[model samples]
Target chain A: EPEVTQTPSHQVTQMGQEVILRCVPISNHLYFYWYRQILGQKVEFLVSFYNNEISEKSEIFDDQFSVERPDGSNFTLKIRSTKLEDSAMYFCATSQGVYNSPLHFGNGTRLTVT
Target chain B: GENVGLHLPTLSVQEGDNSIINCAYSNSASDYFIWYKQESGKGPQFIIDIRSNMDKRQGQRVTVLLNKTVKHLSLQIAATQPGDSAVYFCAESPSGGSQGNLIFGKGTKLSVKP
Candidate 1:
């Protein structure tokens, strides 16, 4: 089965520094998404990308957060300035562009903002 | 105010027992629902999904039931094993949004005892 792949399974960044998390979604998948789960908490949607543009984003995806499908297959999430509270497990997922399609998620990138 | 939520934050079951996780959604227009399982350090894995048109769908040892009238969703796992211990989340997507954009519920941690 095809799987989404995220780089740097773990990353530790200093506060106020910029960090870009990279993901390679399934090759044929057209919709990409980013979600985060704080330790022992619920997973929260960050943003969804389709057609090279953001389709939807949650309030948590503020000015400091941005997403890009830099290449046809590489979906990336960049945080302009990391905060201590930004420490969490960031997951990248992808799905076919059909309604009700199930998302395939990557193992996740553990971002530790110190 | 669209939101998906679980009935309980945690559940405990014996290895051979059946485990049921429940969820509720406030969106009457939500037509697609999915259940995902997340182990301690991994991303959410798709377990099962049900559309509003179907009341029940089964896969392997897992089953998903959707009640559109009541805006409820449930996942059932039979003969649970130690590997089944994980946080289970239910997510919903309203029609007309990005096909894969989902609103996740606060997950329920399932503990299976051997």
Candidate 2:
């Protein structure tokens, strides 16, 4: 079974700095998504990417957040200025098709903003 | 087993028992629903999903029941084993919206003891 792979399994960054979380989605999958879970909170949707553009984003995906599929296989989430609240485990998921198709997730990148 | 600091609602069950974790979704327009299992230090793993047209769907050791009338979902695990201990989450995705943009509920931690 092909799986999503994330880079820098864990990151520790200083507040006010920037960090980019990388994900390599399944080769044949088309749609990609980014979600985050604060230490004790529910997993929250941040953004969805398809066709090399952002399809939709949540309120949490504000000015500081941006997603880019720089290459055919890599999907990256960049936070311009990290805040303490931004510390969370970020997950990348991809799906073969939209409706009812299973979303394959990566092991997640733990971002610790201090 | 491992434990996460999320302090989620927990259900303790003995091995070989049936465990059901419930969720109430906030979106009535969501046509796709999924259940995910997350162990400590790992990402959410797909378990099963149910579509709007169907009320029930089953997988290897799990079943998902959807009640659109009340916007509710439940994941039932049969003959639970100690390895089944993990946090379970239910996510919803609207049909007409961006395809895989999901909204997840707070997870319920299920612990199985021998």
Candidate 3:
């Protein structure tokens, strides 16, 4: 029943400010990911991380966004300059393998930009 | 771009009844599929998954059926309870892609009433 844990369940920031969302994935998981869900929209893939580097990213994952596995257990997403459109629920997920295995998600961090 | 979509935006079911949600994908290369439940203000929670090689997979009170030829997926919940009310999403991943990188469909909201 291990779960991914996120910090700052809710965050409000001014447009143009910097924000960092943190997540601690399951201990044994080898792959980590970041996804975002805009209100009333489908959850969108942002980036995937494995072996300490980005494995793949979507178009939505632009220069303003970055992800890091800063430690053995911590994975983080940093937005250099938040825009109003950046407001969404950011989710962190992990999986034991790259195929056939289910991804486990965190409760999510709600990012609201004013 | 490939996309995953649900047939309906919302479904209402009486408590103790069975519920079924359907999804369609446009990607023929996708070999893995997963169903997730997202309560309001939360991240997507894994429900069940089926690989292209399997036509069906069951877990607890839920069953997932896959039609690889038609690129269709369905989730069935037996004896649905009020707690089962949530938005259900179907996600797809291409063969040989990172497991954490998933393409999600617009969710179908399920409302269970007593």
Clashing pairs in 2: none
Q: Residue A107 of model 2: what lDDT?
A: 90
lDDT of 2 by residue, A55-94 (tens): 8999999999999988677899999999999988999999
- CAPRI-style class, candidate 3: acceptable
DockQ of each: 0.44, 0.61, 0.47
TM-score of each: 0.91, 0.95, 0.94
Better of 1 and 3 by lDDT: 3
Best-to-worst ranking by TM-score: 2, 3, 1
Deviation of model 2 at B23, angstroms: 1.2
True contacts kept of 1: 0.61
Q: Arrange candidates by DockQ, descending.
A: 2, 3, 1
- Provide C-alpha RMSD values for all models, in order: 3.7, 1.7, 3.4
Candidate 1 residues lying further than 4 Å off, grouped into runs, are B1-8
Tens digit of lDDT per residue, candidate 2, span B1-114?
Answer: 123566779999999999999999998888889999998888899898888999999899898999999998999999999999989989998878787888888889888999
Residue pairs with clashing backbones, model 1: none
- By DockQ thresholds, what CAPRI class is model 1? acceptable
What is each model's TM-score for chain A?
Answer: 0.98, 0.97, 0.97
Best by lDDT: 2
Q: By lDDT, highest first, what's the ranking? A: 2, 3, 1
- Native-to-model Cα distance after best TM-score fit, residue B84 in candidate 3, in Å: 0.6
